[model samples]
Target: MNLKNKIVTVIGLGNSGVNAANLLSDAGAVVRATDSQDTPATREAQAALEKRNIKVEIGGHTENFIKGSRLIVVSPGVKESSVALQWAKEHHITIISELELGFRFSKGRIIAVTGTNGKSTVTTLIGEILKSGGKDTVVCGNIGNSLCQEIARIKDDTWVVIEVSSFQLERIEKFRPEIALILNITDDHMDRYNNFNDYFSVKSKIFRNQTADDILILNYDAPYLRDLKKKTRSNVIFYSKKEGSSDAYVKDGWVTCVSEGKIRRIARISDIRLKGAHNLENVLASAIAGLRAGVREDSIGRTVKNFIGLEHRFETVDTIDGVEYVDDSKGTTVDSTCRALESCDRPVILIAGGRDKLSDYTVIRGILRERVRQVILIGEAKERIRSSLDGTVESIFADTMPQAVELAGRFAKGGEIVLLSPMCSSFDMFRDYKHRGEVFKEAVKKLKTRRVPI
Candidate 1:
């Protein structure tokens, strides 16, 4: 792990890769970087790396770079099957992620949160609660800034709350956090893994290296977690929305946490700023992590009461005239979109489609038929979504975001919710969910006329 004076090659120039390269260079590592893109798309990033005096190779991975590197830090976006990766493996070079490098230099308690959904909300909320409690804290990883970027800002008392993903977890070694959390896991990122079991295995790595002294928080209701707990050696803390046999749950409107023989009632579900059953579970997880980090009960209660939800994940974009527009663009999977649809009280003109990850949209049909008033499909997955719900709802297809917004607006009544909760990846139309959400906002802004109430 002594990166000093070592020849390290960062295998991508994405955010994580840039951070890794810069951090390694700062630590006196002989850093060299490589990227696949050389067109106008990646020219700026390539220029930035060269400006930093780091050697840059673009257009393709060079064999010399792989042969010359003593260590390789692969970005999450690059799969292990890349020729450069395979070449490094054959030569016995060490390959690690930015997370592993960050973990090496970190000096405080790490509270790592991993799940298919609700991680960003939970991680941010936990950091906020801890900060309100007077703890020096930094929220980093998949949700926020890279850990290396914030290394100089951290103090000994700093509490690190990291939003971890399966891709980041895949390359980690000795990156154990003091408190590890696995929220509900469902069929997600099916494009990355060979199967559901393979994806689950990588997620379970969040607790793989922990000892008995470390705490592993899990959703007792998640069948995946239930099976993984039996395989882990760490001490477990279980939370659930279901009745009985859980460390935490809500009953008669109060959110309660029972650890050993002690019972603690944190807050009421009605008191929470974020709505939906999924968010209530998020609230519980955040409160527990904050409490374990020695955050004050009053601080936890107050933060939960005032916490505004993250953007693009059940975010209320606008309510023009009468129709309400909600941007849940972060609902990249079928389960999340199902939750978003169910969260609405009014009838929904569900805007759902994007790059299909070979995902089955049939799973959410029951909710679509009962809750969604109409379906506005867009992006590459339109036909699949249309075929899945052909007869269940009035479905329309649009090729672009603006057109989709206009079509959805035509069908949206005064009392209905216009929701952009694409149940697939946004790569077909935009950079990511954030980009998709912003474009959706722009499209909604262009609509000046309001439909008369029926």
Candidate 2:
């Protein structure tokens, strides 16, 4: 952990990569960074790092750099089996994530949230509640600023709220959160892990090192996580959208968290700002973390009332000629898009298809057929998605986002919804889900209104 001119090599020049390299350099570490892509995102990052005297290798991994470094810091997106990482392992050099490094310097209590979905929403909501309670808080990790950049200057009383992913958790050692929350675990990132169990184990490690004094919060409704609760040694506080099973329960449109026979209730579900049942799960998890952090009941209710949703996750784009358009670009998995469909009360013209995440699309197929009036497919996995849900719903293929939006606009009737909720990834057609959502919104805005048959 000593930063007295240590030679630290950063792998993958992505968002966390560039930020980590900068942080290490700022801490007086001799930093060298590498990435596979030299695209605009990476190139712009490389130029910025160059101004700070950091060395970067783009388009390929350099074995010499890995062998020569005293320590290697990896970005979350890169897999453990990546060539540079394997090289470092063979050379017996220590490899760690930015989160691990951040923990080494962080002074405040860490409230970490990890799951397949809704982690960002829960993390943000918990931060808001703590801040409203007059606590010094920084919402970092996958949602806000990187922890490596934020943790260094935070005061002792500050709260570090992080939305960690399975990728981040895979590399963490001794990075324990005071309140560890597992929102829900579904089949996501199967391509990253050896299997579903491997992914689940990595996520469960968030509470693996925690003591009895630390809090472990889980979604009791999720079968996978509910089963995990029985295995973990940490004291658990369970939450659910249904009644009777969880320590925190939502019944008759209100959410109540019961701990040690003390009940704290949020008056009405309608008062919660974020949309969808998925968001209700987020609110419950956040409330549990807030209570664990000793946030006042009044502050928890007030913050829940004021907390809005995250971008590209069921964001309403526009309504043209009474047809609603929604962008849920953050829904890059089958489970996420399924919740998006469940959130709608009206029939939908769903836009889906992107790079395959090795996810079985059948789970959402029945929901789509029952709730969606039509589907416009785009991106790399269009054919696979159509193949998976053949004859269940009306499907159309479009290579471009504008064309998909145009077709959806044509099929959308008044009072019906048009949604862009690709149940896969955005690597095929856009930079990421944000760019994909922005393009979908722009295309919907350009839709011309015309009289259509109901």
Candidate 3:
């Protein structure tokens, strides 16, 4: 893995690419980074890379910059279909994901979590539990902070807890984690992947390099994952909300884990601070990984109990005139939004729609009928969502977040909820889900001010 005097090109000048370039430069690799677009953040990243003697090409990728490179490191955002990547392939240039590059340079064991949903929650929980048990833990990847940036900080005993995505997994080569958890895979990222099976295959790459000594945790509730035992050599463990017949399950009102032929209670169902059955699955998966990683039961319990959940995932913005405004902008798929809707006890006025992922919104028809009172649609996917949910629920279309919040506020009455759980990506309007969630919160805040008696 000696990178001295080697030529390397990094595709996509996002945070991960910039970090990769810097790390490669530090390792004495001559790095050239390229991106299709130039932004303020990318510019800052470019300047930082330039200080390290790394060349950066923005606005478009150039073939000359990619040619004769010893290796090409791809950021998750970059597609395999990119012309430069295709050229690299044709030229027999070694191309690896940023995840792989990070792993090659990092020391100690790694715990990687991947899934369509609940990756961040599970990754964070695992990091927290490990830290609580006195383990040196560094959490990074997809959640934020590229793994390459944290690789230098890894010590012999450090536990690298990373939230991996299918995009990252798609390009992985020898990027095996000591402990790998696939929370659940549903129809997601259809816009990027050709089909659902293609997406699932990319996710399965996470376990490709795992050996029998490693451990892999999966969701038993997902039928697609039930038969993955044959796919990997690693010891497979299943976590489910149902009782009995799994490595981790809820029985007698407690989240229990079967380890070393002994059943142990990790935490009570009521003790989990995060709402929803989906979160219960997250806790169960994390608890198994925690216990397997040598974290004490008390430490796992304490972490889960205290974990308030991540922002933008079922996050409560504020209560205005007895109506609760929940920001679930992280619900970037139909299944995620349905789970959010199912988790709610009160009737909801759901604010949904964004850049559609080619998801079948009809999958959540039953939940929409049972939980949602009225649906306020926004963003590019509004019409598609409305068409899918036309007869299932009452609908309203708004052009902006403020308009959506105002409309929801009008429809929402006392004891009801106004939820922003857009079942689509926020790229059409906002920079990302976090930005979308922030805007939704700001709009809700303004709604409160408007309704306040001066």
TM-score of each: 0.96, 0.95, 0.98
lDDT of each: 0.86, 0.86, 0.91
Which portions of model 3 miss their true places by more than 4 Å? none
lDDT, model 3:
0.91
Clashes in candidate 3: how many? 0
Compare the candidates by lDDT and give the number of the best one: 3
Task: List ranges where model 1 is wrong by over 4 Å.
Answer: 39-41, 259-261, 449-454
Instruction: Give all candidate RMSDs, comma-separated.
Output: 2.0, 2.3, 1.1
lDDT-based ranking? 3, 1, 2
Best by TM-score: 3
Report the lDDT tens digits of candidate 1 across residue range 4-61: 8889999888888888888898889999988887866457767887888888888999
For candidate 2, what is the lDDT?
0.86
Q: Poorest 10 consecutive residues of model 2 by lDDT?
A: 445-454
Q: Which stretches of candidate 2 lie over 4 Å from their true place?
A: 448-454
